[model samples]
Target chain A: MYGMISTWRMAYEGVVNQFERLKEGEFAGNVLEASIREIEDFENFISVGYGGLPNEEGKLQLDAAYMNGSTFEIGAVAGMEDIKNPISVARLLSQDRFNIFRVGDGAKKFAESEGFLSENLLTDYSKNKWEERLKKVENEELTPYDGHDTVGTVVLDKDKNIVSGTSSSGLFMKKKGRIGDSPLPGSGFYADSDIGGATATGLGEDLMKGILSYEVVRRMGMGLSPMDAAQTSLKDFEEKLERKYGKVGAMSLVCMNNKGEWGIATNVDFTFVVATNEQEPTIYTSKRTEDGETVIEKAAAEWVEEYLSNVLTRQE
Target chain B: MYGMISTWRMAYEGVVNQFERLKEGEFAGNVLEASIREIEDFENFISVGYGGLPNEEGKLQLDAAYMNGSTFEIGAVAGMEDIKNPISVARLLSQDRFNIFRVGDGAKKFAESEGFLSENLLTDYSKNKWEERLKKVENEELTPYDGHDTVGTVVLDKDKNIVSGTSSSGLFMKKKGRIGDSPLPGSGFYADSDIGGATATGLGEDLMKGILSYEVVRRMGMGLSPMDAAQTSLKDFEEKLERKYGKVGAMSLVCMNNKGEWGIATNVDFTFVVATNEQEPTIYTSKRTEDGETVIEKAAAEWVEEYLSNVLTRQE
Candidate 1:
């Protein structure tokens, strides 16, 4: 009943893997930032988060928030810049009892806790080069549009518990002190295992006004499938904004209860990549071509197929 | 059982009121645009579908879409700017059967058919000064954070059937040709009265990825209260994004089912305003702040009090 590498399917892959791993306690209390960091694409994601769209002043500022539904706890930091790995701080908050404020402080604390020689190692030379570039570009001509670019994730356990979180450097380049939905809970990410979960990207304030995630989950509870739920939530939100505030942009999610059901809806045509159990993950792009709702399904379907195939062969 | 203005709520209000009015045959297809145009705070909500954010050249570019779940039909337009009311075109498509395209001449033809006079309103000196000033700025610099706006609605009739819709202009002063969640079905809005209905706002991409509305409806079918369902969806979506994206942002939602049981949930620290038949419409400017979750009881209680007071006075 479920095998489509559409946007929704890719998201389901991520969610299912997280849940499967969680069942084995492989991701205890630290699902917020344990991405496959060694992957180059993951690094690119960090760049998108940190050096992405700027704020009004073109200065780089950052904000992020995370929550683990398994524990019903969350942590966030706002208006920070020049710090690498905001997600790491969120991870620490999810794992450790102490609250870490600034990214610098969080890194120091984490290094000390992990017994690393220098906290700066987290920002190694290449990462520092990005930081240096951030400093130089702080004074660039800033525009209101630059304030964007963020990331987030959601995970559901086998027991049907769901958790979601997000991180972002506010906009592209920006005013010194600007805050978007990144640190905000529902606007950035909202999860309910019994129903589903959601995460957002793009314009924060616009989504916040509608309470995007909450709407998606509520609809799912009524019986819509995960994909339909996501689509409807966004449709309603956009309609209202057009009638009221006008300008807005963003992307995110709503995932169904843990039977590996989920959906991905986007305002703009974009691609969402995915990988599955022991598979070399690939990206899937969803856009409207000549035909309505043109979806490039199974671009990455082979990943899961190959992995499962290998397992079957080994058993044989 | 709710009060607080979120983009999601605004969207719900639009679709709910319009669909109801439309089903009652309040106006011919053309008049639906005027109806949506009359919503309170119309100017600010440029993101959904009306007078949206401008393109790189500083001219407003708009995108919008609509769907009828009952018929499984859809309509959309993209890259439309300087059009006063895009919803009118979308509603036209929803009401009538015709060839539809995502913007360009097709949408223009529809608008012209509906008597939409595009007379370069931006250059008119008598127009609102802020709008004129906004026109002076280049669109590339426009950001999505200009306003807390979004409008959508979903409604169910006595037959237990449902319909939902959304609209948005995208972020203010945005780059040329930037489209948000408004035009994408499911990402923008979703409704299935047989299952349930939901609307969303904030972070268009995020809502799309998670399929927020579909998830909520499914959960409702599982028998969770509307409020719980909404909260659970938000929680789960947020947790997922936090794991990959890091920083999170705000989003809000309003949902209802066949029984008219409505639920509201948000990750924002407040800013979600709600109004229902049982309660007077009220606004929430702050979250509980204790746990960062929305506190609707206070606002809901106040609404109840005001409603009850009015009822008793009338009886006396």
Candidate 2:
């Protein structure tokens, strides 16, 4: 279970295809690694990889983190420049216990030592977007494609070892030195073999505040099913933020329990693709209740129960 | 409950004293804001305030976040420069609901608009440290003081409201724009009025990954005592990291419940000062257990059980 880090329904298929490949044993080792690398290589998804949105200065900076639940070891990089596939770099970096994290020029230099290639991540589409954003930026005008929505994925391999990860160009026009939830373990992603795995998208800061993924996996460990965990965590987070910030930022979470139950929750009606078995990937859309009691938005208390019984369970 | 944002045991007095002032009606509103300002203005602490350490480029880049638990409203600034009291800037920023977070040059610009004074945060001591660090950095030398250990504070005010926040100079020579858990919510600090509040110090990255403070408070909401919650969260985090990385980073948590119960937990033997109405700022030194069970670095689980049974019972 994962997200385009956090994109619309239309962007889900590409990754869903990657999931399908994984299901077919197209490759070995960590499929999450392959999945994210493919997404990063896919330039059409500008929020991550080869053509991820650049920082405020128009320099493409990347952030990625990966965790292997079996070992619970993690590796991360932030503000990593020049690396075409940060998830790959993160995977490689995770190999050594000496330094599981790196950033900036140091990360670039390390990638070179490890024989990783470097490239210009900005494509014509991203560059044009940047240029267009520059024009409106000074005037504080906003764009829907703020160069963003992270690309995060979590795969529960056949061994039932749940590995979770997320990589992003980060929010559009973020500060040159800004680091989001992407590379921070537990904040952006978390996986525990005894419990489950979770990956988050949407406002990185809010995700950080909720420590959403870790919280989900922990809740699952404490016995809440994946669906219950996602709904409760999102509802609680929204309430926590609502009292102070009026309206909460848009964010979402995806989860997979050890039992194989899967779920997604968000502050808005959000969509994610699931490739369970030979089925062509189906987009699951979760809508919050009108009373705002459950998960995404101000969800209703009974929404997830209804949604799961009426919608998700049927899909499974 | 509070922390020096991870300061020296002695420095804890200053903030504890400020808490006393608040108790005696020596000031108005949250004293956390004032206490942090005092710490930031103090030149002795290299991790925060006027004499805080600089980035690799030898510029002081600061990060801070403040939250009023009563409202659950949060405000933060990252990579902010030329500000002596970043916590102050964060405090002022928290007033306007328009923006809950900001960063870098944009943060500086916002601080200016808010009439916060600008000053170089570098001191000769910090400059000398950075210079020596530069000499050894090429050799990849390591030091315990990476110029970070946030000065986090959380106050359960007379009204029993929880307000928590943190400020930092960031890790020594961190990537030019690197951000630690200091300015982000949940990781650096967290407070919820009904349950309790928490603040952390030590390895900011590790703290962020665990989001220990919020987790602790949430555990309290789940019915664990303050000490129990802190110990369990820290242990779980350490175990999780140990499985993947062999050893864990240095970090600690301080917490308080609405019942006026307080506690501190760490992976190392740590001490913090506490003062309440009748208490004269007693220093509590929590010793870690050999097998790592208690609150405060390898603490004896039995110790917390006794303390909670004695102190917390009286508080209520």
Candidate 3:
């Protein structure tokens, strides 16, 4: 089943709205790139692309990754700045005959040579957000949350091929030169003909601690449903972290099999968007049972509205 | 069933020699720490510790990671310099009560506060290595080999716990702030009480593209022997890369199940060491048959002699 999904609803909406382009026979890669372009341009999400938060040094160092599943080719950049759409730059790097990966200034130079326009990604809103935190920090500051959230989209194309892309400004006030799972190939997302596709959002430090996405995908390969794979991996992730920090550790994942079956899993109750050929885009909220099982429920719009602005902000 | 293994013979020898200390009932953590202390001080293995390779700027930047299997805790540092024993520093970060991760100056500051001594890790040999690469640049340097080889050791202790540590200088002449699988918990290594333990070497870029170590460990959980897990991962790694580059990519792995059954796999032909209670220290060579299957052979002393200085020097 051909479909697309993202960590944020707006991001998924931006892509699914472009589903008309697929009807017009546009390339899958172009749709994937255009999707993140929407998130990069969206002002509401403060965790990815332009207007996203900055590092401790007050610089918006971005990391972006894109993978072409049929070809098993990948492109990524870490600490790249100035480019408006890093996912496209990542695509350029992967498609270019000369290189598959570049970093920092070299990546920027490569993007420029490939005709990507350079611009400062920081916007007034993000600047204010960072400034507010700094002001909140008195002579002594409280430990802030790992506020890094990424824009990840996994699409299973008409041919059942999966392509995925991820972009992030990374942890709020994360260390300078810090590169998270966003730009890493397997840690952030993965897909194959043998398995399906999977992507993650949350504490990358925690997600990167285990197979995360691939664990779910390979479990799918082992005949577990996408939801079961995701739940199993999350169970392990929780057990791994709960020992030290009680119930702390943030991560949520979505999985899609080539058969067009998709399942969702998350440690906390949160909603993600789903788009497919037979249905309008809908939201699913994943909740954990008291017995430590994952449950997926269709989220009411009113509940989603409250969850996004209120519940998510508290998490940040 | 409790044991430790490393890439370098000298490193493994250091830990196995401490069998007496185990008999005297020393903590496994202390024994694991002491094992890596030898590698940290060894002058050979230019990819690790002091005198290792430098970044493009001619400054030595190091990456190290440590994991406690029993607690499922992980600590890592990337691009840290002026530290002789980054593996131990990683251990300190994991053991600390207040912090789980710190990077760049914050990590350096924390290390200093934790009483870690700072000194230039670059050695004359490493300095010359960087200079030579720059001088050898012709018109423009070609895409160099992956060139990243790390020091990873997995220890299974008396209580059947696993603790692993990886330390590296990353790729020869890599980007100034580039971080690789060495510091990533899953991409480079992963362990679970049910799944067993695994670690990797060579070309982190390739290994991180898949859930290399975790894939191996998960296969072990599925009833595959440690050797089968390693072989399956390496095969998939080769198939994935071969499709794109036609016989390009580099990686090696070691896997040890909770049962103390262990195996080694690599894309390139090389030998690694192993030692346990029932066996003397043995060097095993991984040779591929004409059908491209990996088979282990007892490496002769004479063949090992030429392979090390000849093959390893060429790889460097």
Candidate 4:
């Protein structure tokens, strides 16, 4: 019962592209990496990979992580620069028992030494967007922070090995060297082949405050269904954050148990992609109900088309 | 009840220095910061702050984090260089709602912009130690990585406000920009004013795989005694790591519940300092038993004297 789930509409094509290989019995880690690399290579996905938005300093610093559930091996790079595929670097680092999490220039140097290509990551589209946002921020016309849609995924293979990964350029126009939950274990992603795996996408600062991804997976381990775990953890943490911190930002989580059952929860209008042995890759929209539950349904054909087209047109 | 517990015998003086202010009703965050700052200023402690060991590049890179249990606010810095008080920077960052975690040069810049004085963190003693280790590592007589003792602390003030903080130079001779669990939330430290707080010190690479600190605090929240929580969480994670990753590293944890009760667990001979309204600041040594329980005893006068003298002599 192979299965995969990922945050955001941007992951739909990547999931679709990888389903065939996964069905052919590809390892969860490889399939997860390939799926994320697809999103990373696409220039239209402004929140991840090559063309992602730059920091306040106009540099494209990336953050990514990969975790092996069976071994509990994790590797990550935060504030990495000039690396075409941060996810691959993270995957490589996971093989080491020490210094698995590297940051900044050191991360870049490690990737380069490991033969990962160092390319100029800033595309004109993202640069223009950054410049435009910088003006508005200077004029106080808009807040400097927004658009942190991290691409996070969890995969379970035919042999039941599970893996979770996340990649992001972090918040648009964020402070230099600022990193979100994308590169953090437990907060951004957690996986255990024996139970399930979970990944999160949202305002990383607030998300890290709750370690929502790990909580979702932990709840699943405690006998809750994947859906119940996702929804209940999100609801509880969101309420706790609101009461304590006075405000809560956007948070969405996706999870899949070892049996290939999947779940999702979100506090805003959100979209995700999922594929399983019994189902083809599909796009779904989700929202939180007033009753502290999640409402998820297959997105309409038109809505899917519009979303994909919007992503493409943004490249202009 | 005002209480504080910090990892390592090095923290004894700092805990003693701050107990009076804590008893006088200083806020938990302020007391935690002040206590940690005292440790950071002490040059005798080789694993943290001033005179801390350097990375392979012969540069002192520091990591630190602060969390407010009441507000669930977190701030961290990783791979920062030339910073005198990383704990203070982390505490200041906890007040921000975004971009609270910074790394490398960006973290250094943030601290400088905040008016933190920039001083050379490396001392002659530390530099000489690094040089000697470099030769031994080159001769293949020793592994490049060792000595990762982070000063982690948890404080419960008179008002029951809780806070957790950690500071470290990371693994001695670690790669440049390598970070341990010290700056990462949940792995290094976790706090909830209504429940408890926990902090970790050891091989961060292994500690992060289990997220033990957060798990310990979560167990305490689930109604376990602090001792039970610490022992069970560490024991479980250590065994899991051994099975899955082939081996586990030396790990030690210190936790304090909001009621001022404290607990400790360690896979190695470890020492920590604690002070509460009912007890004066005192140092204790702890180790895990074969039966998965912790054995803690007050440090012998001879052992304490020898330890302090050893630290002082190392500076020569």
Would you estimate the TM-scores of all the predictions?
A: 0.45, 0.78, 0.86, 0.99
- Report the alpha-carbon TM-score of model 1 versus the true structure: 0.45
Candidate 1 lDDT tens digits, A38-68: 1112332332343233333343445565665
Global CA lDDT computed for model 3:
0.72
lDDT score, residue B203, model 4? 95
- TM-score, candidate 4, is 0.99
Write one digit per residue (lDDT tens) for candidate 4, span A1-316: 9999999999998899898899999999999999999999998899999999999999999999999999999999999999989999999999998899999999999999999988999999999999999999999999988789999999999999999999999999988788899999899999988889999999999999888888898999999999999989988898889988999999999999999999998999999999999999999998877876678899999997787788878833
- Per-model TM-score of chain A alone? 0.67, 0.84, 0.90, 0.98
- DockQ class, candidate 2: incorrect
Per-residue alpha-carbon lDDT of candidate 4 for residues B1-316, written as tens digits (9 for 90 to 100): 8799999998888889888899899998988898888888988788899999899999999999999999999999999999999999988888898999999989999999999988999999899999999999999999988799899999999888899999999999998789999998999999999899999999999999888889999999999999889989988887778877898998998999989999988999899999999999999998867876678999999998888788878733
Please give the fraction of native interface contacts (Cα pairs under 8 Å between A and B) kept by each candidate.
0.00, 0.16, 0.17, 0.78
CA RMSD, predictions in order: 16.0, 8.6, 4.0, 1.2
Best first by lDDT, ranked: 4, 3, 2, 1
- Candidate 3 residues lying further than 4 Å off, grouped into runs, are A79-84, A95-119, A135-143, A177-179, A239-246, A289-316, B9-13, B16-24, B95-118, B139-143, B243-246, B293-316
Model 2 lDDT on a 0 to 1 scale: 0.70
- At residue A62, candidate 2 shows an lDDT of 84
Best by DockQ: 4
Tens digits of per-residue lDDT for model 1, B198-244 = 76766554554455766676678689887788789878878766764
In model 4, what lDDT does residue A30 have? 94
